[model samples]
Each structure stands twice: as structure tokens, then as C-alpha cells.
Target: MRVVILCGGESSERDVSLASGSSVARALLERGHDVVLVDPAAAVPVLAGPLRPGDVVDRIAVGKEPPSSSGRERLRSRMHAALTGGPVLELLRGAELVFLALHGGWGEDGHVQALLEMAGVRFTGAGSAACAAAWHKGRAQAVLGAAGVPVAERVLWRPAADEVPQGVKRLVAAGPVVAKPVADGSSVSVHRVDSLPQLAQLAAEVRSGEVEMLVEPFLPGREFTVAVIGDEVLPVVEIELTTPVFDYAAKYQPGAVSEVCPARIPAEFAGRMQELARRAHQALGFGSAAYSRTDFRCDPSGEPMCLETNALPGLTAGSLVPRAAAGAGWTYPDLIQRLVDLSTR
Candidate 1:
């Protein structure tokens, strides 16, 4: 199969996406599948190349910070031109399957998925509607809560139009709360607030820039993530954070945190988390065989509360989905092949 792995979009997670694409390309090549890596954000769209063993580990390293937004507007203009009607579109149209190894931008937020849908191209992961639903934290939580899946209480704030919600103010006054962009990934700009002043500062910054944000009570328990593929929930992976918050640096930087697959937890607790993850994925309208990863943090009583569902979870070598899949007895190459099979089915 000829697969075009899309990655390195004009998003904060571009480095992570590139790493994932590089790893996926190598794995697909190992399985004798023709793989072309295309970064739609690139001026020229084509990044095809040969892969040697350890190329991903040796060459593609995510920086401590995302690429600067210095020339992003110009790059976005170029990306838009390249993706709409050019060699990039032709490449996508020519692929047997476009493995969406993208994260946290137009690529993962349903815009690209919609484009592919309209172009009649088959790609991995959730459909456009599902991606849109799951990409926004507040929207995803609403859908999950409505579906009877346990989720933390969240208040949506549109800083541009409305002042901070009284509910958010109350939550902050009571205890620690988390504030983050309603629609973003890689834990970018996610902050833990312990006081009203801190919350107010964050709201001000958000008001000056983005439109929407979500405020929820901070869960102070172990963090675990479950990956679901084709209705099968892989084993849970526990994230042991070395830092106070699992910020972007903690996520992609090697040795910044530890991830333990088949997390050391009671069987019943793990099973319940798996069920909640599956429920969250389906609640967002993901296809029966689609893949997703649902993150969770336990409440004070140890009950798992869904954070958000990732329609296009990171596929980096150290990403949670791949780690959980390893716990389920699948090699990295096997997991990539499984996704391809599921998407094409």
C-alpha cells in the first residue's frame, strides 16, 4: 500500500508530528509499504526520503519549545496555497491511504479531515465531525457527560465576549483549577490555578488572544490514558510526571516524565477506565473501528474522570497510544499496520 503520512503542520505540535511521521514512515517502509512523508505546512509539500534504522531517534528531536510563531502567518499562507490545489493535493489524491500523523492544528482539528473527505481520500483516525467534536475540550466533555461517561466539571468561557464565568471564579476561589484553550492539544498553555489572581491573569491573556477557554477543577490523582482501536481498549498507561504539570516540555522531552504501560493499578480500576475510554470515544461519534486515546485523572475518591478524547492521538515512538498498544502485545510496526487495516476496512 502506498501511504502518505501527513505531519508537521503549522501548529504548536509540529515537532512532535514530524517525529511521529518519521517513525511511522520508517515502520511502514520496514513492512515493505511505500510511504511518502508530506508536511502540508512545507512550502513544497514533498518530504519523501529513505529511512535508516534509528533515523527518527537520531535526527528528529522535538525542541523544548515549539517552533517560533515569528513567520507563521506567511507559512500558513504558503500552506494554504499548497494544500488547496497543487502537488500536495495531487499527492494526497494519489495515495492508497493517508495516515494522519498530525496533531493539534488544522490538521487534527477536522479542517484537513473535511478536505480529505471532500476529495474522497481515505485517511486514518476519526472522521471530520468526530475530530471537531473531540478536539474541543469543552465540547468533548459535554458529549462525554451526556453519554454517562464520568468527566470533570468544566465551565466554558469566551473571553472576548463574556467575562469569566461565575462558576469558574467560584471554582478558582475554592481550590486549584485548570485553565486551557478549549481547542488545543499537547498540553500547550494548560495551567493550574490556585488563586483568583492567577486565574484572572490567564483569562486576561486569553482575552487578548484566543476566544475560548475551559476552566475545570484540577484532579490530584494518578494520570492514566487508554487507547482504543477498533472497539478494543488497549491496556492503560500511567503517566508519572516529574514536574508539577505535564506541560508541552514534559510531554515530548525525553526523560522529562515516565510512562508505565499496563499501569500498576487494581484490575477493576483499570477495567473501569478502559470502559470509560471506550465510551468517551463512541460518545464523540468515532467509527466502530476508529482509533482514539482518552486521558483520565482520578478524583479524590480515586474515580477516574475523563479529561478529553484525542481523535488523532500522537503516534510518536513514546506516545501513550503506542505504549498501551505495546502492553497489548503489538509491536510498533504492528500497531501502524493495524491502524491502516482499520482505516481501509
Candidate 2:
């Protein structure tokens, strides 16, 4: 089968997406599938040759900080032109499947999915509606909470508002709170506020920016993520963070954190986490064969609370979903093959 792997859009997670695309392209090539890797943000999309292991390591290595927004608008403009009608669109339409290795921004937030849907193309991962719902942390929590999935108390706040939302104020008063962009991934600009003053500072910073934010009570418990591929729920992966929060640096930088697959928790608790992960995925209206990674952080009572669902999670060497898949007895290539098979079905 011919596959077009889309990655590295004008998002904060661009570097991560590029790394994922390189890895996926190599795996698919090894599996005898024709693969073309394209970074939509490029002035002219590159249909690179078959990728070798570590071929793009230096070129696409994630930095401690996300790519600067210096020329992002120009890149987005080029991306828009290319996707609308050009080599990229033709490639997408011609491929048997378009593997979305995209992480955040317009790529993973449903815009690209919607475009593909309109063009009648088959793509891996969730549908546009599901992606849209899952991309917004506040909305996903509401959907999951309504479906009986436990979630942290959160409120959506527009930084431009004169006063903080009442719900945010209440959460802040309760305890340390987490403030993050409502629709971003990879923990970009995510912050933990221990006091109203800290929140005020964060609010001021965000107010000068454009993104809306979500505020929620921070859970001090262990962090675990469960990946659901089709009907199969992979083993839980526990994240041991060395930093105060699993921010962008801790997430992408090597040695900043540790991931333990088949987490060293009781079988019953693991099973419960798996079930909640599945519930959270389905609560966002993901298709039966769609894949997602649902994140959880334990609360004061030791019960896990759903943090968020990643519709298009990272597929880098250190990503949690692949680690969970490994615990489930699937190799990296096998996981990629499984996703291709599931998407085709």
C-alpha cells in the first residue's frame, strides 16, 4: 500500500511530529509499503526518499524549547496553499492511507482531518469531530465527566477577561492548580500555580498572548497513561517525573523522566485505569477502530483521575503509547503495522 505520512505542521509540536514521521516512514518502508514523508509547513513539501533509521535525527531532533514562532505565519500560509492544491494534496489523494503523525495545532485539532474528510480520503486516528473534542482539554473533561469518567475540576478562562472565572478562583483556593492552553499538546506553556499571585502572573502573561487557558486543581499523585488501539487496551505506563511538572522539557529531553511499562501497580488498579482510559476515549466519540492515549494522574484518595485524551499522540521513540504497546508484546514496527491495518478496516 502507498502511504503519505503527514507531519511537522506549524504547531509547537513540529519537531516531535517530524521525528515521528521519520520513524514511521522507516518502519513502513521496512514493511514493504511505499511511503512518502511530507512536512506540510515547508515552502514546498518534501517527498523524501525512503528513510533509514536515525536518518533525520539531527535534522528533526526536538529542542528543549519548541520552535520559535518567528516565521510561522509565513509557513502556515505556504502550508495552506500547498494543501489546497499542489503536490501535497495530490499525494494525499493518491495514497491508500494518510498516516497522521501530526501532534498539535491545526494538524491534530481537526482542521486537517476535516479537509481529508471532505476530500474523501482515509486517514489514521480519530475523525474530525472526535479530534476537535479531544483537542480541547476543557471540552474533553466535560465529555468524559458526563460519561462517568473521573476528571479533575477545571474551568475555561479567557485571559482577556477583567476577572478570573469563579471556577478558576475556587480551584486556586482549594490547592495548587494547573494552568494550560485549552487546545495545546506536549505540555506547551503548562504551569502549576501554588498561589493566587502566581496565577495572576500567569494570567498576565497569557493575556498578552492569544490562546485561551484551562485551570484545574493539580493532582500530586503518580502519572500514568493508557493507550487504546482499536478494542485492545495496552498495558499502563507510569511516568516518573524528575521535574516539578511534566512540562515540554521533561517530556522531550532525554533523561528528564522515566517511564515504567506495565506500571508497578496492583492488577486491579491497572485494570481500572485501562477501563477508564477506554471510557475516556469513547466518551470523546472516537470510532471503534480509532486509537487514543488517555492520561491519568492519581488524586488524594489514590483513585486515578482522567487528565486528557490525546487523539493524535506522539509516536517518538520515547512516547508513552509505543511504550505501552511494547508492554503488550508489540514491537515498534508491529505497532505501526497494527495502526495501518486498523485504519484500513
Candidate 3:
């Protein structure tokens, strides 16, 4: 199969996406498949050959901020290349399957998916509408809640000059709340706040036009994530974090959080998590998604609450989906091959 692994969009998760694309591309190459790696943020550059594993991994460092000026200029040039019939879009045109390794912003928010669908390109992951619905936490919660899925209480807040919404007040009254961008991944800019004043302060600092704040009551119990590939649900992975929330640093920084695959929970509870993960994926109309990851938290009463669904979950070595796949007895290469095979179906 000739595959173009598209990654490194202009989202906050650019570095992570690049890492994922590299891993998937390397694995695909090992499986004897032709792979073209494209970083859309770089405007889909022309590559002479399959990316070297070492070079791909070393391309980007993990951090929260945007890329430096030189990096930004390079990306700008790349984007211009795509717009001007550059090698990126040209390569995509002749590919058998466009493997989407993109995360956050335009890549994961259904924008790129919509374009792909219009171009009649077969790609991995959910459809455009599903991506849009799943990209925003607030929207995902509403959709999932209506489908009878258990979700944590949440309040949405945009930039407002007046007063905090009543929903925000209600959420804060319950307990500490987790605040984050509705559409971003890798826990970027996520915060756990205890007071309304802190939320106000955080809200005041927001200047981005695209990000809307989502505040949900923080679940103090265990956190778990389950990955669904094709029709199978991988093992549940539990996250033990030293920090209050799985912020940007804790997520990408080594030794910041301890992860246990096939989380140390009762068999029945693990079954329940997997079931919810599947149901959540289906409820969001991601039945055709090549692969996806659903996150959940157990409330104080041990009831699982769906947090958010990811249409394009990370495929990096340290990503939760791979950990869960390992627990389910599938190698990373096996998982990548399966996903590629499923993309056509």
C-alpha cells in the first residue's frame, strides 16, 4: 500500500502529532508498505525517501509553547508550498490512503477531514462531522449525554466581559473544576482550579480567538483511557499523576506520570470501561473510525464518567493507545497494520 502519513499541523499538539506520524510511518515501512510522511504545518514538504526513525523522532521537542520564529517561517513556507501545488498536496493526490497523524486544531477538528472527504480520499479515523463533534469537549459531552452515556458536569465559557455564567458558578460550587481548551489535545493549557476567582483570572488571560474554555468538576478518583481499533477495544490504561491535572508538562515530560496498562481494577470494572469506551465511540458516530481513544474517570462512587473522545489519538510510543494495545497482545506494528487495512473498509 502507498500511504501518506499526514502530521504536524499548526495546532498546539504539533510536536506530538509529528512524533505520532513518524512512529506510524516507521512501522508501516517495516511492514513493507510504501510510506510518505507529510507535515501539513510545513505545507507538506517534498521528501526524497521514507523518514529515518532517528531523524523523525529528533525533529521536534516536547513543550507547550508555539514553535520559534525560524520554525514558524519554515512552516509558513511549507503551507505556501501546499497552496501553490507543492509536493505535499501532490503526494497526497496519488496516495492509496492518507493516514491522518494530525492532532488538535485544524487537523483534528474535522476541517481537514471535511476537505479529505470532498477530495474523495480514503483516510483513517472518523468522518468530518464525527471529528467536529468529538473535538470539542463541551459538544462531546452534550452529544454523549444525550446518548445516555455518563459524563461529568461541565460549563462552557467564551470570552466575556460581563459576569461568569450561572453554569460556571454551579460547577465551582460542586468542587474543584478542570479547565481546558475545548478542542485541543495533549492536555495543553489544561488546569485544575479550586475557586471561581482562579477561573476568572484564567479566563481574563485568554486572547486566542479559536479556543473556548470548558470547565468540568474534577473527578478525584482514578483516571483511565481505552483505545478502540476496528471493532476491538484494547485494554484500559490507568494514569497515576503526581500533579493535580495531567497538564502539558506532565503529559510530555518523562517520569512525570506513572501509567499502568490493563489498569489494576476489577475485571468487571475494566469490562465496564471498555464497554463505555466502545459505546462512546459509536454514540459519537465514529463507527467507521479506523482508530480512536476514549478517556474516562471514576467518580468517588466508582462510577465511570466519560471525559472526551479523541478521533486522532496519539500513536507515539508513550501514548496511551499503544500501552493499551500492548496489554491486549498486539505489537505497535501490528496495530498500525491493522489500522491501515481497516482504512479501506
Candidate 4:
């Protein structure tokens, strides 16, 4: 099988996506599959040919610091060129399947998926519509809530005309609030605050129109994530963070958090979470998705609240989805193979 691993775009999660694509490509190559690595953010010259082990491994990043503003601009420019560049499109059309090892941004938000669909190219993970619905936090919660899934109360707002809306201010002023970019992942710009002033500052920054933000009641409890492949739910994984919030640092930095697979919780509790995760996936129209990972926060009362779902979850070794799959007795390569089969079918 010839697989084209599409990854690394202009999103804040670009570094993570590159690491994930690199890992997936390496695994596929080890299994004797022909793997071509394409980092959309890189220049066109790098978009062709089978990836060398050293090229992919050397790009693995451990830091969560997002690319600088100028860095982001350059990436966005290169990405735009790559998307329209003749060579990249030709490569996509030639692959047996395009393994979407992308996270966040246009890659995970349906843009790239839609393009692939239009070009009649098969890709792993959820469909374009499912990705669009899952990428937006506000929309995802609405769908989950309508399905009777527990979720924290949240409001989406862009500083209306450069002024923070009254409702948004009240929500932040009332008590502890979790402020985050509505469509981003890896916990970028995710903040927990109790002061109205602090929230006001965040709102002002988000008012730039480049980013839409969401404010939700800070759910203080244990965090857990479940990975769903086909109709089967993998084991639950618990996340313990040393920081006040599981920001980008805690996500990518070494030893920043502790992850326990098959989470040491009661079987009944784990079962409930797994069921809810599956429900969330289906409710969001991901029933036909190759795989997905849904996050949750257990309230102090021990009831689970759906956080969000990822249509294309991270494939890096330290990522939650891989850990959950491992607990289900599937090696990383086995998981990759399963996804490839599903996409090509």
C-alpha cells in the first residue's frame, strides 16, 4: 500500500501533528508499506518521495510552544502554496489512501477533508461534516447536550465590536471559568480564571476576529479520555496534571502529567464513560468514522461531562488514543494498519 501522510499546517498544533505524522509514517514503513510524508507547511520540494527515517525522527518536537506569529505567517503561506501546488495534488491522487495525521486547523476542521472528497481521494478518520461539527466546541456541546450527554454550560462569543458582551462578562465574573479558543486543540489558550478582569483581558485579545473564544464553567474534577475505533471503545485513560490547567506544556512536555490507562476506576464507571464517548461520537455523526477520541471531565459528584471529541486524534506514542489502544491489546502498528484498511475499503 502506498500511503500519503498529510500533516503539519499553520495551526497551533502543527508541531504535535508533525510528530504524530512522523510516528505514523515510521510505523507504516516498518510494516513494509510505502509511506510518503508531506508537511503541508513546508515548501513544495519537500512534499514528494518516501520519507527517510532520519528526516521524520529529526522533526519530532517535545515543546508545546506554538510557532511565533511570523513563523505562523510563513507556514500559512507555504501551506496555501502546497495545497494548490501541482506536485502535492498529484501525490494525493496517486496514493492508495491518504492517512490524515493532522490535528487542529484546516486539516481537522473539514477543509482538507472536503478537498480530498472533492478530488475523490480516500482518507482515514471521520467525514468532512463530522470533522466540522466536532471541531467547534460550542457546536459539539450542543449536539452532545441534545443527545442527553452531560456537558458544562458554555457560551461562544467574539468581543462584539471590540467590547466584551455583558453576558460573557457576567459568566466570567460569576465564578471560576474556563476560557479557550473555540476551534483549537492541545489546550492552546485554555485558561481557568475566577476574576472578571482576567477574563475581560482574554476577551479583548480574542476580539481580534482571528480567533473565536468559548467560556464555560470550570469543571473541577478528574479528566479522562476514551478512544473509539469502528464500533468498539478502547480502554479509558486518565490524565493527571501538575499544572493548574492542562495547557500545551502539560500535553507535550516530558513528565508534565501522569497518564494511567484502563483508568483505575470502577468497571461500572469506566463502562459509563465508554458508552458516553461512543454516544458522543455517533451523535456528532461520526458513526462511520474510522476512529475518534472523546474527552470528559468527571464532576465532583462523579458524573462524567463530555468535553469534546477529536475526529483525527493524535497518533504520537505519548498521545491518549495510542495509549488506550495499547490497553486494548493492539500495538501501534496494528492500529495504523486497521485505519489504513478502513480508509482504503
Query: Cα RMSD to native, each candidate?
Result: 2.1, 1.9, 2.9, 2.1
Give the alpha carbon lDDT tens digit for every residue of 1-345 in model 4: 888899888888888888998789878877778878898788653553575434444448756586654577788777767766488888888888889988888888998888888888889999899999999999999999999889988877775466666767777777788888889898888989788778767666666556777888777789999999988899999998787677888888878899999899999999999999989989988865468899998766878899899988888888888889899999998988888877666
lDDT of 2 by residue, 191-250 (tens): 999988898888888786677998888899899999999889999999999876789999
Candidate 4 has an lDDT of 0.83
Between candidates 1 and 3, name the one with more favorable TM-score: 1
Write down the TM-score for model 4: 0.93
* Model 4 residue 33 lDDT score: 82
lDDT score, candidate 4, position 135 = 94
How accurate locally is residue 148 in candidate 2, as Cα lDDT from 0 to 100? 93
Tell me which of candidates 3 and 4 scores higher on lDDT.
4
Query: Compared with the true structure, what per-residue lDDT tens digits does model 3 show for residues 206-303?
Result: 74353578888899888899999879989899999898887777877778999999899999999988888888888888875457899888788979
Maximum-TM-score candidate? 2
User: Could you give me the TM-score of model 1 versus the true structure?
Assistant: 0.94
Summarize candidate 1's per-residue lDDT along 152-265 as a digit string, tens digits. Answer: 888988777656678988898879988888888899888899998887777677676655888899988889999999878999999998776788989988899999989999
Query: Runs in model 2 with CA error above 4 Å?
Result: 50-59
Which sequence of candidate numbers ranks them by TM-score, best first?
A: 2, 1, 4, 3
Instruction: Assess every candidate by TM-score.
Output: 0.94, 0.95, 0.91, 0.93
